[model samples]
Target: MTAAASSAGIRLRDHPAFILFWISRVCSALAFQMLGVVVGWLVYSLTGSAAALGLVGLAQFLPILCLTLLVGHVADTFDRRRIVLACQTLSALTVGALALAEGSGHAGLLPIYAAVVTIGASRAFEAPTMAALLPRLVPGEVLPRALAVASSAMQMATIAGPAVGGFAYIFGPAVPLTLAAVCYGVAAVAMAFIRHVHAPGPRSAMTLETLLSGLAFIRRSPVVLGSISLDLFAVLLGGVTALLPIYAGEILHVGTQGLGALRAAPAVGAVLMSIVLVRRPPTRQVGHVMFAAVAVFGLATVVFSLSSSFLLSLGALFVLGAADNVSVVIRSSLVQLSTPDEMRGRVSAVNSLFVGTSNQLGEFESGMVAALIGAVGAGVVGGVGTLMVVALWTRLFPALFHVDAMPVKVETRR
Candidate 1:
């Protein structure tokens, strides 16, 4: 590592609160990832129906879609630390219940689906609350590096979580679920250790205005709107997650094992890019950097779609992941830094809504498109669409695209 990067790491290590938060985040993320792999495998094994697997994702997402406004309100009104702890505990219990059901031979499709929806609901609460708390744990100047370091949970979860769960599944499906429950438990405990638990400031009652405040806050800020929406439209249009199985099975002709590698490739790229950001956090022209990253994301998708060779496809996925990591780090830092302590939860919930929905919706979009044209054609179309979003977003949210520095903080209007 360069001396400067090494120096940055040491400074970050000085904050004990961030350390605890990071630990909790890693544990929580790992639990979620483990649960995901096992659930998919178990569902597919039980039903052997592709549509059933699709329903599993839909089941998880529906709660988030339904609960977005309420979840954000609760986060803003209550103690974020306790909120996160409670949600993690709930996840542990719900997943544990699923594991017990499996062991007892009562783990039917309905039981699994029920547990997934409950877990999803808890996550909808956990994610935004966690995000709202991060800015409080570190100083404004270091927030970018802090965000980069925190992205490690995503990187670790993306790469290691499934791999660990898959290995544990060799013992039995229940094993991974059991491990996931344990991880959640650990996450809850770690969250409890955070020193400064924020109590939200005095606010208006839970009225229609209060509920819609988050969306309003976002809409008023062109930068926030642009960054968040850019991610939504870009990923919603560009993501090829739903097409991976098809590629592994038919297009790439690599089979299930190949699918595993393909799934991990983007994450691997993300991890590498995150490390670079931690070492040398973006300081200027971040707007340009993010747009470029999104463009690369699009270009890589296009290349991957056109590639016939498996090795070339993997390389394309690697580039795609790396580009995604850059844009995500920049966007996340910008959002948290710009939002106020009081309104962070609400705004973050809206952000979460876009991010959370976009993944599944993107898959759904990709699947629908592929059904009509084919996987390769669908990918190419999605990539081009992402590039078009970049062009249009630059024109629409000029402040974000031309920004030289991310906002340090903003006071929300009540």
Candidate 2:
């Protein structure tokens, strides 16, 4: 490594709170990723229906949709660390319940959905708290690099989690679920060690106007709105992850191990890309880069959808992930930096809603389409839709396209 990069690494490592935060995030991500693999496979194995897979996504998303505004308010009004600790504990307990259900051989779709709903509620609270907490852990100048490091850790966990879960399935379906519970437990413990203390904001009365503030802010900020919505539409249109089980069994004929490989490919690419970004952060035309990267993501999705060969599919997924990492780093930095400190929690919650819509709702869309046509047809159509979205979004949000650097200053109306 260059002397500058080496010195920066030393600085990052010297911060105990960031280290602890990073550890907690990695453990939590690993647990969630493992739980995802187990849930998707088990749901499919039992029902043998594509729509059932979509239901799993819906089950997790409903709570977020219902409680996101309230959750954002809580994050801003309370101690962010405490909120994370409580939510992590809740997630651990939910996963433990899932493990018990599986071990008892009484695991049904209904019970699984119920457990996922509980986990989803935990996520709805946890996401904004964590996003709001990050800027407090590190200096403002290094926030972009800090975000990159955090993303790398998450991608690393993503790479390992599914592979471990898929292999653990050999012992029994419940084994991965049990392991996921253990990871969440570890994550909770790590979160408990974080000593960063954020003063609670003045509490506001619960009201419709207060809850809508986050939405109102995003509506007025063209940069934030454009970046968030671009991701929302692109991923909603192009997401093929919900169909991995089908691809593993029907299209690719690769079984469980191959399913694990398919899931990990994107993360592998993301981790590599994140490392590069951390060393040499984006300097100019960041908005353009994000747009181009997303377009590349759509193209990669198209290639993956058309490929029948395992190696070819993996390559496409790797490219897709690499492109996604670029968009993620840029968008996350932009959202956090542009919004004021007091409003970070609310804004982050709004951001999370966009994410949930893209991921969970996208899964539902993918499943319904796949059920009607076929997996390949759904993938092709989604990829095309994603490209079309890029063209439309570019036309609609010129401010997003013209942004020149990270840590952009935007005028916000309070």
| Top lDDT prediction, candidate number | 1
**lDDT (Cα, tens digit) per residue for candidate 1, span 218-237:** 99988889999999999999
Which residue pairs collide in model 1, if any? none
Instruction: Give lDDT: candidate 2, residue 211.
Output: 87
Q: Which ten residues in a row have the lowest lDDT in candidate 2?
A: 1-10
State the displacement of the C-alpha of residue 108, model 1, in Å, after optimal TM-score superposition: 2.1
lDDT of 2 by residue, 1-414 (tens): 123334456264566787788888988999998998899999999999988987887788888899889988888788899999999999998889889989999899888888888988898888778988888777666777778888888898877887899899899988999899999999899999998567777887979988888889999999989989999999999999998889999999999889878988998999888888888778699989999999999999999998999999999999999899999999998888888776788899989989988887788899999999999999989998999988888899999998997774432223
The segments of candidate 2 whose C-alpha lies over 4 angstroms from its true place after superposition are 1-13, 39-54, 97-112, 169-175, 243-257, 370-377, 408-414
Per-candidate TM equals: 0.95, 0.88
lDDT of 2: 0.86
